[model samples]
Target: MAKKGDMLYAWTNDAEIKKHAELGGAVTGLWKFALESKAVDAVLVITKGTDLYDAQPVLISDPKELAKTAGSLHCGTLLMPKLIKNYFDGAANMKIGVTVKGCDAMAFYELAKRKQINLDNIIMIGVNCGGSVSPVRARKMITEKFGVDPDTVHKEEIDKGQFIIEYEGGHKGISMDELEEAGYGRRTNCRRCKMKVPRQADLACGNWGVIGDKAGKATFVEVCSEKGANLLEGAVKKGIIATEPANPKGLEIRGKVEGAMLKLGEKWRKKDFEGLGEGKDRLKKIMTETSRCIKCYSCILACPICYCVDCTTKNPAYVKPGELPPSFMFHLIRYAHIADSCVNCGQCEELCPAEIPNALFMHAQQVELEKMFGHVPGVNMELPLMAYVEEKQERARLKNTGSDMIYENVFNPVLKN
Candidate 1:
């Protein structure tokens, strides 16, 4: 039987699934097993859209339809938790199996904390993410940088610091660094993201470890919790998949990969934040950037953490309906409400018609709060700093308290600040 904290190399035993899946099809096999064995009522997945560049989230109840969601799409940028909470009745009624990237997993944790989702009825399968490309940007990159027709591309993969693409005749690969230098690559928020592995999820699966002959043919799976272990053991017992202990070298390699990605992320963070200047300069930069906003509310709609049914943004006193470039209060209200919970998913910035760097500013605010209160959002079930200090006395104490004093007085100081 699978055990919590067990790390193994696994693959789908089914030939068709192995052939169609990105890496050994272990994820697809597990989803199929969950549905056929009644472990879950439905599987939520992203399927290929009109073309290889498009991806659409779908809910599949039939095992036969699982194949359509086998492969990965780097251009698929939707966050699944909001859909589960807002559209699927918070998944309170049906058991579900869903795939998650780092952001999606964090969003799930935040939603669970707010009682928006029934975590008892959900199975989270975490996937490793380097980053995702915007569809429009990806098309342009292919056409100009790769000198290939974007429509002719059939497949894409990001590996070893390169963006690889495959078409009918052959394939081409470009250095991701080169692309970013040319003003094209992963989303800005993604480049600064440090969470490459979604360890918070039940099962963390990826191809980061396998090497040599097994390099592209197997998946490295980390059973993170009891629920994840049960799913793996059950699938194995039912002959849905095969597993073996992961190679020590594989695990070491995976650590090195994660370390390298984090280092690069740190570099990007410094570069991106440096432009904001400091003190009054930073405030001026923020004001200048947000002044372009046309009050489309696209950022609010795209945010996974925004759950208020009757939002203050809709109220005339706060944001004034039908006003163009609505007052700075509009953006300030959003920052204050979500700064503690923002997961840096980039949806807000990506969806903004004004092209404001919503995620960047929010993330900057979150970093400051993290320093002041030592609270990192979406990592666990803990309530945000604002949640605990709703009372006027608590707010007054917090305002007057020094960072070190706050760290020593209220919460665990041993935690990262």
Candidate 2:
């Protein structure tokens, strides 16, 4: 930890960074600062390819390359394990910088608890998540709406209750509010998210609702730890950037997003977080919804936490070639496996071409699991809550099987009936 009052700079996605002798544009100022900071041994940014001209998450040492990958810094979520593996593989001992979302940061926290990475030497820059889109679906939309040629599409977003798809050749917008919009940018995992802010992060940054000023300059920054504060402070003291209070509108937007999630949580509470119906009905729904799947294995690739040496789907011992759906059991088993650990990031649902809404399913189950266990998966690192530990203290915290609760007030009143 660098301690409080260290060098730091923060900004929204709209903030532009003037590079060495190059024209300035919207860039993740932190990445630019890291590039300028010769003290940093290496910089690892986990961002999307499309965001910065399809730049991958890798080491960017040269200033020019840093500029090219600057768009990646705006990404709200970057799966943690991939970046960690990159560091471990390189065997880099020097102070390194990496980006992660709230859930991904929590994933790192879990891994750190298990002694997976050395957190002392690393710089964790976090971003508050709005959501994410599957690259495959994004490409599909481009291809279907405006031809697959990269030159055709210029920009994309969900605007004014419509999907605004802009192109160099021509532009067209679809009313997402009207259409049966599924897949791609519509993140299913985000629907059940309760935490949008990065709690365990050293530094948190995002755009969410923060746009630049009339001068087109807005900065989104949150210092969660001593090192993060120091980084931003150093940047300001060194005259690299200016600081201002976050926009009040940003806080209002944050509240709305949080409120929406809380409402969803309340709905689940009313449902008792139980299965929709009996075993047959629930299984039938799963089968019918999953029937559309052709087993493209895209979800497995997008999933941040699904890591197995060799997946059973690929193993000859478990699966054979030319299997259309690969058995509903595989889907159910895989869902159950990741259910407890799922952070509700929504990548699986976003990536699935079949649009199965597995993310929502996970979210519903997550509520139930949380109610049952009184645990939030990766919130607290000091105490091991997700993993089962024998403790008399926890027994009281666990949900009772209805038989455990005493019927004192309600039951006595019902005797009159």
Candidate 3:
């Protein structure tokens, strides 16, 4: 049986699953095993909607429906952690096996830090992510860059430094460098993301470096915790999946590939932030850009860190209600509350109605905060510089001392996903 930190090449024993799965069916097999063995009450995954660009999250309890959820969806932009918090009680009441990208995994830790979710009951199976594309931009790229009908494209992937697609009668690939040069690749936040692999999850799996006979038919999985070890060893014992030690050469290749991606991320971070100018110039740009906000609250809602049910912005004491282009205070509330912990998930920018680069501004602030305080937001359970404190402490402060200070700002009780 594999132990935590073990890296293996794994594949499904089920042929039917193999037919529909990508790289390998091991992830799908794991989900099936988890459900059938009562290890988890349900599995959460993404399913295709109308076309390759239409990705939606589905919660499944029946193992029979697991096959359709196999494979990656690079066009998918949904944040999985928030869905669990909003719809599934943060997996607090029920055990769940859910696939997660780096951002999703990090968000879970951040939420757990705030006591919004029960991390002990949730099983996170992380996937290595190069990045994700916006749906609208994806469709346009397929039509114009790939020279094919977007609807005809049935599958897509980022592989060997290229964005590839398989259409009805043909398949084509274009270098990511080329696409991004033309301003049509991954989102700005994704371009600068450094979380290529989520070691914080129970198990981190991807098709990064499976080689030789198993090249296209296996997943490279790194067991990250005791929970992952137990789950993987259980699946193998049950004959639901098979495994072999990872190839040393493949491991070397994987390191190089990951290093290249990291360097690229650094390159993009420099370009994106430097273009905004330094210090005061950058803050000026952010304020000027956010001035157009129609008080939609979309950014606040989309953020994974804004966990207060009675939002501080609506306190009416800090930010007056019914104010158009709400005061700079609206933006300040977000900056103060979320800047130290922003995960750079890109949801705010994606959902913004006014086209503000909210992720860019927030991430820039997070970077600056990281430099000042040496606090990396979501890599672990470590509390931020602005600590997350339980709410009962706040109530006791008011009751015993009769002080109505109301908030420490940083210690607000958070809802975990």
Writing each residue's lDDT as its tens digit, candidate 1 over 1-417 gives 898999998888877787688778999999999999898999999999899778899999999888768989998788899899878888999999999999999889887876778999999999999999999899999999999999999999999889999987899999999999898989999998988999898999999988866788888899999999999999899898899999999999999999999998999988888877888998899999999998877898878778765576776656777877788899888988899888999999988888888888988888888888888888888998545443435445665764323323435445435
lDDT of 3 by residue, 126-163 (tens): 99999999999999988888899998888899999899
Best by lDDT: 3
Each candidate's root-mean-square deviation in Å?
7.6, 10.7, 4.1
Candidate closest to the true structure, highest TM-score: 3
Clashes found in each candidate (C-alpha, N, C closer than 3 A):
0, 17, 3
TM for every model, in the order presented, reads 0.92, 0.67, 0.95
lDDT of 3: 0.89
lDDT (tens digit, per residue) of candidate 2 on 61-177:
664465445543222434655456444642236666776666777666555544445577677777655444455555665566445564466555543335566576677766542
Runs of candidate 1 with Cα error greater than 4 angstroms are: 387-417
Clashing pairs in 1: none
Name the regions of candidate 3 deviating beyond 4 angstroms.
392-417
- lDDT of model 3 at residue 74? 97
